[model samples]
Target: YGIAVDSGSSGSRIQIYSWPDPSEVSKEDTSQWNSVPRVFQQEDWSYKTSPGVSTFADKPHKVWDDHYEDLIEYAEKIIPKEQWNETPIFILATAGMRLVPKKKRDTLLETICEKVGKKSEFLLENCAEQVQIIDGETEGLYGWISLNYLLGQMDDYDVSSEESNDSLRPSYGFMDMGGASTQISFVPYSREEIVKHRDDISTVYLRNVGGGVQQWDVFVSTWLGFGANEARKRYLKNLINILPELNNSNDEDDFNTKAVNDPCLPRGAKLDFLHLKHSYEIIGSGDYESCLKTTYPLLLKNLPCTETPCLFNGVHAPEIDFQRDKFVGISEYWYTANDVFHMGGEYNFLQFNEKVKSFCESDWSEIQKNSEQGAYNNVPTSILIDACFKANWVINVLHEGFNLPRVGIEEKHSTSEEADLEYKPHIPFQSAGSIKGAELSWTLGRILLYASSMIASSDKISVGIAPASKENKPFVYGGIDNPSLSSQLGHGSWSFLLLFVFLGALTLAYLYMYKRDSLKRFPTIFTQITSKLKAKYNHYRYLKLSTQEQTDLESG
Candidate 1:
């Protein structure tokens, strides 16, 4: 079993995962190893709480007391007490920690490691490495691995052998849109493409439990300030910049009260926009076409291309063949499509455009009326107001920015229209919050990697065992007879001798308690036990004789 805590900007979540003991079944036939051990998230084994780990920067000392204490306690309750020492807990911080100052970030993580390690029994072999902030690319790669693994698209054919058949499953592209940043990661179709984008490519070596290491070369990149919320901020700032009169007011009182006509918002919608210590009222025009035109520039497509094939902002990326390479969008992509538009799953340009167009053009009163009627039930008002803009942003990012072509619209003019294109007439993109009832999280990928690495390294196919400490060796109770347990405990050799002495003392105590009247009051429990054993031995000898011999002995 393993625990992963996803420490994000808004909140932190913890998930407990368990798999069958591979050492129990893998030794007999290694060929069936992969099929036997399936990692599963335990039922009701996930918990989430708010106000992120980064919020403790000002008071790092109060982190455990205020933030992680309850979380750790929750995990301890769910996981068996005996297995606490073996289970590994990982606290991986994402965009929230990235935004914090480096010194503060390091200090915060150090506090977490020091407190959680010393307090919690969960395995913390290398506290420094295990509890830390992960870079954007690493996060994206993890998401990619998670998506593929969950979709059952990663294990079609073994990529370990050089002479293996060419039936390996093609990995899907992954896109994650958060509030602060967005990420893209996928395995390139060709080795040439992978090599060409050497700077952007990351090789993930997955060691198969059955045998061998499967290497995956994935291209991953992250754009800061490209996420939906940040993009909206920039768009609003641009609105203020375009209208010079809005900035002309020198009086603080006047500056606090200004209004701008916003094309992106719904008609008659009003938003109290605040930027750089100034406040303004935004009046909506509800023009979807104008909004699309204006928001397209936020992608920064006009930047000078340092690399020939740039995705956006002069970043190099492999050309995506939408027909051949399928993709999945998560986070905001799922929320925007599923919540407001009521259109999730396979991306359809026509349906999406029509829905978004009507939504954006819809009057604010009408939208509110629909919400009151429970049309947008469970969807937050903040999200409802911005759904129109987010939908347009998704369209722009996919078609205008990533150049993912619209389904059946302009295939002939698509940059990916090669002469040998495998013309599959289907939308290649999918937006999903989850698949197979498991939440799509990068933490799963992290744990999977950790488990695989541990299994691959161990002679005994066990994971979650703590690494051996140089100063004080671990103590295994079962001794030499239970080699697997000893190995699992990572115990030192001296533990066996101690185990025997402990058992001997226990046996003596038991005998003394059983035959208190017959045994003499000895200084040590061992002497009393020895006397009791001798008396029992003599009685056993008398009882073993034949009936005639027994009668003759009684007469004597």
Candidate 2:
């Protein structure tokens, strides 16, 4: 069993996989290795929590209790107590962590590693070593590995020096969109460095589990602040940057009266917006042509390309071979299409543009009315109101930024060198987050690659049971044979003994909280209990006052 946590910008997801034992799977037959081990993907339990890990920065010490510790508690219960010593757990912080300052990020990492690693209920072999912030290239690489793994591209297909035609697997490109960033990864046919930015191309080499060496040369890149939500913020920020007058002038009588015209929104639209501690009223220009003109500048596609071709924002990406290479768009790509655009599954760019135009033409009042009438019941009003802008962003990003073939793999390039190129658009995108009813996410690929690398490196797998000192802790792979309880309790006594100490600390914490809560209620309870005594004291004083008044009346 293994646990993978995706600590994303907006939320965190916990996934537990019952990974197959490597010894049980056959290495000779490629078919024997299930696309995803049935037990692993099928029975996986997943849960999520709000306000991602970054939110805990102010209370840095509470980071573990807020999410990480609670998550591990659930995982400990799910796995049998005996197996707790062998389970491998890893958490990969994404863009959210990337945004944090280095000092804070380091502190957060140190806190979690020390607290969680030193005291864990399950087998978290080298916990401190395993958990950390993953870079953009690593994130993109694993996401690519995961999508291709599901697509069955990892299989070894060779027959002595022949039968190559019958033994080929379709490799895929992966595109993941999040709130704070976006990732793109693919295995290009050409080995030569194609991307203008060398950092965009990442390589991972592994020997297939079915018995042959395999190499994956993947092109992956991440654009920070280009995700759906962040892009919207940037789009607004760009308007402010270009038009300073919008910020300078506002109604003198009213503080919140700043308003500006926006081409991207529907005609007759007026809405209040907040950006960088300033406010603005964005009135809709309702001009689709002008909106496209405005959006192109926001993408900055024409930024003096250092390479032959450039995607928006001067980012150098390899040629996107939409015809031959298959791609999967995830996260916001799926959500916006499924919920806002109302295109549930697969859709072409043309269909996307059409829907975006129709939406942009609709007035805000009509959109709100539709939302109120259960047309988009589950979607929030804020999303419904800005649906048109978001849809346009997704479509434009896919089309212009990625250069996805608009209509069936551009026939004009069919006769040229580009056509003769490896990309032949056979299988387009199967836009997905799952295969065979199992959830698909980047963590799966991360775990699989890590295991594969470990397996490839070791000739004779050894579970170092000797009690490792804090300085040189033994490396423990994912779920494998663990020492007997008595053996670990005494043999690996450092961690095992520390576990009891951790439990003792927990008990003390509970007692402290109990006493504190009791003390909190004592004042209220005492106030209620002494209420009659205080009332009697007030009555005696009132009687004395009445007698004094009677004596005065007699004198009169």
Candidate 3:
């Protein structure tokens, strides 16, 4: 059993997974348990609060005193008391943590660790150290892995070699929108596209039958400050600066007294606009068409893009083969479409534009009233205020921003061949927080990686198999392909320790085995060997402890 905590921008979620023990299970063994319950035996628990934990990061003391303690107390109630000691709980902060400074982040982590260490023996060993922010690429890759795995894409691992098998392989791309960043990841149509751009791939090694490893090539990219909330800021800033009416002020008095006409906002609605220490009164012109045009520049396709086919602001992304590729949009993507559009279970991409338009043109009084009926009453004013901008932003980002044609909610034709399927102008987007009763997020992918890492430890694979399990140790920051970055992030000591232990152990083993042979040549050989081993082992132990202490001090 493993516990994964996804600390998102809006809220934090806890996912519990109980899979058959890795020591006894394999790919074939999973078939026997498919009919019993949820996929891989998983359940989710979550808590919602204002402004995420990162918002209180500067006040590190507050996190454990309130938020972290409440979270753990809740876990104590739902999780079995006896199993708590053995259950490995991993807390991974996403984009929100990225907004915080490195020093503050480390300080926040230490406070979390300190609290966990004092908790009852319901958590696994080293639970405190397990809490930290995950890099954007890993978040993207894991999200991709979760989506594909849940969709039955990863299960068809046997699809190899044949060109026809490409259709059977994991093909759906993943797009996740959070508060501080957005991620895009998928497998390209061919190796040529990836070979030329090696930096984009996150190499993952999966444990196969009979102690084998399967290497998968996944292309992933993360755009920081491109999420819905952040994008709103950028969108409004650009719109204000570009429109002559908004920026016509030459004197301080004119700027303060003058009200700018803004079409994205509703008529007679007034907003206190602030950006880059500048302030203004923005009045609504209430034009949805003009709103759409204004939001297009936020995509920044106008940037000096010379290298890769960029989505926006010179970010390098592969030109998506929209006709052939399928994607699942999560986070804010699901929120706006599901909550606002009232398209809960399934919806089409084409319908998104129409519904959002109606929403944009609607009066503020009517918009607020929707929140009062049934499930709408609890909606926050801040979220409601930017409905037009956010909806328009999502639509443009999907179509004009990325050049992706409408695709959603896949409907299958019983006998249609992969190549024979028709390509319509608008494809229905299959959006849901959960698929087949199992929740969708990067938690499953973290489980996949965690499970494989355990399996790798037991398998007699190549020399590099150990690196695959490195993520299992929370202390091991960054991926193997990025050694320098990993070291800078504080995983260098592990590599040093591994080398010292390997050389020291090897020397001791050789000396013990050669004792009799050496005795014939020199009487003092054993004494000499013991002295050297003692010195080396003592030095290694001291260094290991010193490194751990230093790390603790710095983080604390």
Candidate 4:
């Protein structure tokens, strides 16, 4: 029995697979016992500012201790003691923990391990359960492989026919963007001749783009002055800015009415808004419009621009003037001058097309000169259109240009004609209708199965897997292809440690100054007491004078 635990940015799941003898088990029997189950559920876990910032004076663990406790309890309940002890569990954690400081991460791991260790020995007598945190690159490859297996794309090879088989081998790539970071990878097929026997199949390359959270953080920070959490908030606020006003007087009623009436907006777009609202409310008392004002400019400036005037109405208004004399030093409000002009005017496809044409035709020197002089006012829609074009290009390259194998018969023969040659193509497998948005999921599943098969046979695949067993030390594997901008951010345990320490010191200094100011204004307890006594004495004198005046009036 083997257990695979995949912990991603959003959630975590556990799968149990029972390896059985092929001769004894039928396909139906194999499928029944080897099924995956989701044993634990928790709120999507990711790194953000921790409550410990004020108390600890450094970045602290972002994961709640209760989450680990719940995980352990869930595992204990689902996995039998004996089976848990004996089964080799491959635990993989993806985006969430990668962003946190090393000290915080180490503390979290220790706490989790301690909790697991405290479990009753009777519950896990024979089985040894071990946890390993997988690196970003490894996770990317695993996801890639898993998606391929689930998609049924990996089984496309035509091994039966010799001539067509060579041309039918599959090669593909993947690009995945999550809330925190993005990854891009490439995989190529390879075959090798066995020394004494026949041959084996394997991958030639598995290269990953960015996996480090720091890189993503820095990319956003240098450009946007904030991280993913902040950028997402600004993006949503911009959306709300464009939303048509509702007739309702109550704000909550207005929001509900708009949401129900305009159901055509993408679900992700809604989620982005919800997440932004929640985060903003939790961190500050500012209204949605004010938050947008604070965040929108940074998002626009940081957004990648191979060409000029990258615009997204969902995040920024087109009228922003990054080059204005008053705005020159304000990095927070900067945006591509072109996007500002386009989004500020009427939103139409034709207007966007004309803007792009102007940009493409204009000389670079002239464009720069106009920008500096604050003369350029046209908004270009090319940036958003370009993003769509890029996504389509990737789809085409992977689906058609890549050498994916096709599983179909090349020829048909009839017994009556002495099995005479007739050329025809027949589908070898039945189509099981395509899933709408599960293409990535299918690809990831396929790659895992392929890698497992290769590893089982000791094949020399380009992608290497560190032994899942605890006896072997964890090792690095895979390469970076088409590196994401985030990958350029520096990441190291020492660097994180230094950053935390510096933050801690700065926090301590601020606290000390605050305390000193308070003390200087209030003084000590003795001085406070003396001041109170003097004020009481003056009040007593006033009361005595009033009593004397009353006595004089009685005598008269």
lDDT tens digits, residue span 1-556, model 4: 4444555444555444444332233233433222221012122211122222112213224333424334444555655677665544443444555544545544554433334444422121111123334444444455445433333333322223423443323323333433333333333222221111111112223211111000000000011112233334344455455544533355654343233111112111111135324321111121322332344353334555433223321221112121220100000111221232221211122343344335433444455456566554432332221221122222222123221222223322222211111111222111111122222232234223322332221224443343222112232232111223233223563465478569756765775777666545444754775566434433333233223221111000
Deviation (Å) of 520 in candidate 1:
28
- lDDT, candidates in the order shown: 0.70, 0.61, 0.61, 0.31
lDDT of 2 by residue, 160-184 (tens): 3223443324577888888778878
Q: Judged by lDDT against the true structure, how good is candidate 2?
A: 0.61
Better of 1 and 2 by lDDT: 1
**Please, what is the TM-score per model?**
0.75, 0.71, 0.74, 0.35
Task: Give model 1's TM-score versus the native structure.
Answer: 0.75
Q: What range of 10 consecutive residues in model 4 has the weakest lDDT sum?
A: 212-221
lDDT of 1: 0.70
Tell how far residue 239 is off in model 3, in angstroms. Answer: 4.4
Per-residue lDDT of model 3, residues 364-430, tens digit only: 7777677778444365777767767777777877787667766554644223111111223333344
Query: Which one is best on lDDT?
Result: 1
lDDT of 1 by residue, 259-329 (tens): 88888999999999887677878888999999999899999888877676778866767777776788888
Pairs of residues at least 3 apart in sequence or in different chains that clash in candidate 3: 84-122, 371-376, 371-377, 408-427, 408-428, 408-429, 409-428, 409-429, 409-430
Sort every candidate by TM-score, greatest first: 1, 3, 2, 4
Number of the top TM-score candidate: 1
